[model samples]
Structure formats: C-alpha cells, structure tokens
Target: MNILIVYAHPEPNSLNGFLKDLAVETLSAAGHEVIVSDLYEKNFKAVADRNDFTELNNPEKLNYIQEQYHASKNRTFTSDILEEQDHLLWADIAIFQFPIWWTESPAILKGWFDRVLAYNFAYGPGHYDQGNLRGKKAMLSITHGASSLANYGAYGLKGDLDERLFNIQHEKLFFCGMDVIEPFIFHSSTKEDAKEGLFNDYRKKLLNISNEPVIPFHPLSHYEKGQLKDQYKTSIQQELEMS
Candidate 1:
C-alpha cells in the first residue's frame, strides 16, 4: 500500500515526532511505500490567500473559493500546493500525525487542508463520498494532553473525543470519500510508560490499517433535499417527532 504521513510537530524529539518516525519505519518494514510530510520542518504556510493562485479569476474582488475553483480548472495552483496535492493523489492511505492544540490540529496542518484540498478537486457539487479522493483511506494518529477519562462520557471535562474530531473524520476525510479509520489517540502521553504503550499500540494499528473498521458515516443516499431520510433520524429526533 502507498502511504502518506502528514506530520505536524515542531520538536523532532517530541512524543508526536517519535510516533511519526515509528509510523514510517513500521509501515516501511511492513512493505508499504511511505512518504512523510513534516509540515513544520518544511516550513509550510498555514494561511490561505491569493498566493495560492498564479492567476486571479476576478481581480476586482477576492473570493478564495472562486479563485481556487478557477485555479484548479486552469491548473494554476502554486508550486507548493501542487506538490502536496500530488502526494495526496499518489497515496492510498493518508495518516495525519499531530498533537491536538486548542481543541484542533495545529495551524499549519489546518492550512495544509485549506490549500491542498482544492476546490473542484476535494469538494464542490456532487462531493462528499463522490469527491475526487474516493476509495482512499485516512486516519488520525493524534495525541492529547488530557487523560482518557477526562475526555469521555457526559461528565468528562472534555466531553467526547469523537465529537471533538467529527469535523476532521466526518467533514474532511469522509467528505472527500476516504474511508475514515477509527483514530489512534494517545492521552496523557508525557510519561515514559505511556509513550511505550502508545508506541506498541500504534505499531499494531499501523500494521492492521488495511483491516481496520471504518467509521460509520451516513451515505449520500441517506439524504434527500438536504435532510436525512425518515428512517435515519436519531432517537432524540424520533421521540420529538421533529419536522
């Protein structure tokens, strides 16, 4: 399998960095062709602006989506954006390795999404499960500062980790039609023992990625006119008989 690991962490000696290394080594040893995009090391840009395009669709006004759509159609994306997109296209599996910051991925990684997942390529009309990246697989290899219990259940301080990551798993990867794997999340990874445990678990997960169960996302067929089909309503919605 062709794999791409988009790694985001400043310190090479950090826990996230170590996991990134482990992923490359383990996957390569398993006979997969692996590529790592160390965002910080590459000094990737995190903000989206006119710089992404070589030509403007409308010089009088700046609409990023419009410009991106035009650029994508005309093959005018900047060199950096094109390079990342090329890597994305070459990979069968994409693993995002990052430490959660302020409840989401770091700015650089987020920016990578903004620029690389271009208009008409990643999403537009008939997108989400029908997007250009269909048939691919994606997973989040994440690290969190809080303990597992703190991020669990109704009473947990951080609520549900799944809920927190819904945007990335459901909106981003699923929208692009990639089978989203259940994330490998390590909590309170500051300790030595925790690091060891995380390493072991991650190695196992990487080796079994092809067989991992994908997260269940409602198919496009489950919606009509932007509303979920009647048979697909949640229990709360069913009880309330929401119209």
Candidate 2:
C-alpha cells in the first residue's frame, strides 16, 4: 500500500518529526511505499489566497470556493498545491502527524486542508460518503502537552480529547469520504516518561495498521435534511456531542 504522511512541526528534532521519520522507515519495512510532505522543509505556502490559482474565474472578487471549483476543472492550481493533490491521489492512505495546537492542527496542516481538498475535487454537495476521495483511508497521529488529565472527560482540564478532535476527524477526514480510523495519539509526548513506550506502540500500530477498522461514520443516505437520523447515532456520539 502507498502511504502519505503529511507532517507539521518546524523543528526536525521535535517529537512530531521523529515519529514522522520513524513512520517512513517502519511503514516501508512493512512493504508500504511512503511519501512525506515536510511542510516546514518545503517552505510550503501555508496561506491560501489568490496565489493558489494560476487563472481565476472572477478576478474582481475573491470567491475562494468558486475559484477552487474552477481550478479543479481547469487544472489551474499552482504546482505546489497540485503536487500535494497528486500525492493524496497516489496514496492508499494519508496520515496527518502534528501537535494539537489551540485544540486543532497546526496552521500549516490547516492550510494543507484548505488548499488541497478543493471544491469539485475533494468535496461538494454530494460529498461525505460520496466524495471524490471515497475509497482512500485517513488517520490522525497527534501529540499534546496535557497528561492523563486530558482523558478525564468533561471534568478534564482540557475537556474530552476525543470531543476536541471530533471536528477534525468527523468534519474533515470523514467529510472527504475517507474511512477514517480512530486516531493514535501520544499524550504528553514531550515528556521523558512518555517517549519510549509511546514510540514502541506507534511502531507496532503501524505494522498492524492494515487491520484497523474504519470509524463508524454513517453514509450520506443515513442522513435526512443534512442531519443524522437519531437511530444512527452511536453511543459515543450520543453520550458525547461528537457532531
């Protein structure tokens, strides 16, 4: 299987970087071809603006979505964005590796989402389970500063980590029609105690990732008027406001 690891973190010596490096070697040893888009090393343009499109449908106004849709049909997206899009299409799965900053992915990853998952290509009205990237798989590999306190649910100092990741997992990954697997995270990855055990776990998980199940995101037909039918809500979604 082909895999793409979209990594974000400025420092090569950072925990996020080390994991990304390990992923390349580990996944490759498992017989998977791997590609890494090191955002910082590439100096990837993190901001999405008019520069994204080589030609514009409406030069007078900056209608981002409309431009994206137009670019999708015209192949007018710049080389950088096009490269990332090509990497996505070529890969069987994409793993996003980053630290949870402000309860979300780093700004560069957000930019990657915005620019690569363009309208008419990644998503549209008939998206969700039916989007263009339908058959692919996606997963998150994140680290955070908080310790076990993050797992304390609503009472946790950081709130529920699962809940906090709902937007990224459900809204973004699932929205793109990929079968998103449950995220693999290393809490307090920066701490000395968390390093060895967590790194070993990550290596083991990658070797067996092919057996992982997709997260239970019901298909579009399961929705009515753009809302999930109540019966479709899983205990996790019902107990915690995942949507």
Candidate 3:
C-alpha cells in the first residue's frame, strides 16, 4: 500500500522526528511506497490567505495559486500548503505525525488542514452532501510531553486521547467519507526512557494496519434524542468557563 506520512516538527533532531524516520523506514522496508511531507523542512506556511480561497471562481487570474493547486493535483507540489493535498491523493493511508502543543497539533499541521482540505476538496453540504475527498483512510501518530494518565478520564483529564481527537481526526475525516483508522499515540514520547520503546511499538502498529479493526462512529442511538441540544450547550458553557 502507498502511505503518506505528514511530519511536523521544527527541530529535525526531536523525538517526533525520530519516530517519523522510524515510520518511514519501516514502511519502506515492508515494501510500501512512502511519501514524507516534512512541514518545517518544506517551510510550510501556518496561515491561509486570500489567494487560497479568492481564486475559486476564476482559474485564469489564479496564476500562482493555480500552479500550486495543480502541483498538488499531480503530486508535484513544492509549496507546503498545496503539496499536502497532492500527497493525500497519492497515498492509500495518511498518517499525521506531530507533537501535541497545548493539547492540539502544531500550527503547521493545523494550517495544512486549513488550506489543503478546502471547500471543494474536503467538504460542503452540496454535491449530494458528500465530500470530494472520500474513500480514503487516515491515522494519527502523535507524541506528547505529558503522561498517558493526564489524558484519561480516570485522572479527571478531559477524556481519553481518542475522545479529544474525535471531532478533528475521526468525525471530520469520516464525515468527509474517509475510513477512520485507529490512531497510534506515543504516550510520554518526549521522555528519553520511553522514546525507544514507543517508537518500536509505533513501527509495529503502522506495519500491521491491515490487521487492525477499523473503528466506526458511535451509533446515534447512544445519544439522547431531545437532550442533544441541552447537552452540547452545557458542555460549551463549561468549556468557555474553563477557557
């Protein structure tokens, strides 16, 4: 299978980078074609701009933007933002590798989503309410500085790390019709003692993705019928208060 590994880390010598290398090497050694988008090395921009969205109606006036977009279309994109889309198109599975900063992804990875997963490419209520980018699979390979318990419900942390990513990784990706694959988290990846073991585990997981069961979204029957609005409202209020 063809795999695309999107790596985001400012320092190439960081633990996250080491895992990126391991993942790439392991995948290639297993006979899978791998593509790496090193956001920092590629100098990816972390912000979206007018050119990205403004050229939607006119293709002619969008000279530079079109070039970038086409490069992304054909897997030849050199610009950081557009290159991601191209890589996604060429891969069978998309793996995002990054260190969680402030309980979220690095700014560049966030920007990659902001720019690459655009209106027509990712989603819209039109087009039969189906997304343009469908039928793909994705997994997140993340590293965190904190201990695993810090992200679990037992310790009163927000919830499981998987729950925190539901909206972005699973819901968003699956809503766009991609088969949401289980994520691989390198808990406490920043610690030296844990790094080697976590890296080895991650490599094994990626290599054996075909054997893992694809987790489906929770059934709607699991939610209360009339209490949905109230529940979300309360959750939003609590989140605002905490923030």
The TM-scores of all predictions, comma-separated, are 0.92, 0.92, 0.74
Candidate RMSDs in Å, in order, are: 4.0, 3.3, 7.6
TM-score of 3: 0.74
lDDT tens digits by residue: candidate 1, 7-96: 999999988888899999999999999999999999999999988899998988899999988987987989888888889899999999
lDDT by residue for model 3 (124-243), tens: 542211555666788888877665556555554655667767766755676555666778876653567866776777877977976665555532333465244444544533666778
Whole-model lDDT per candidate: 0.87, 0.87, 0.69
lDDT for 142 (candidate 3): 80
lDDT of 2: 0.87
Lowest lDDT block of 10, candidate 3: 123-132
Task: Summarize candidate 2's per-residue lDDT along 1-243 as a digit string, tens digits.
Answer: 999999999999988888898999999988999999999899988899999999999999999999999999999999999999999999899999999999999899899999999998888855888888889999899988775654536878778888888888888878888888778887763468767888998898899887786777778888899888887766545645656
What global local distance difference test value does model 1 have? 0.87
List the candidate 2 regions with Cα displacement exceeding 4 Å.
Answer: 189-194, 234-243
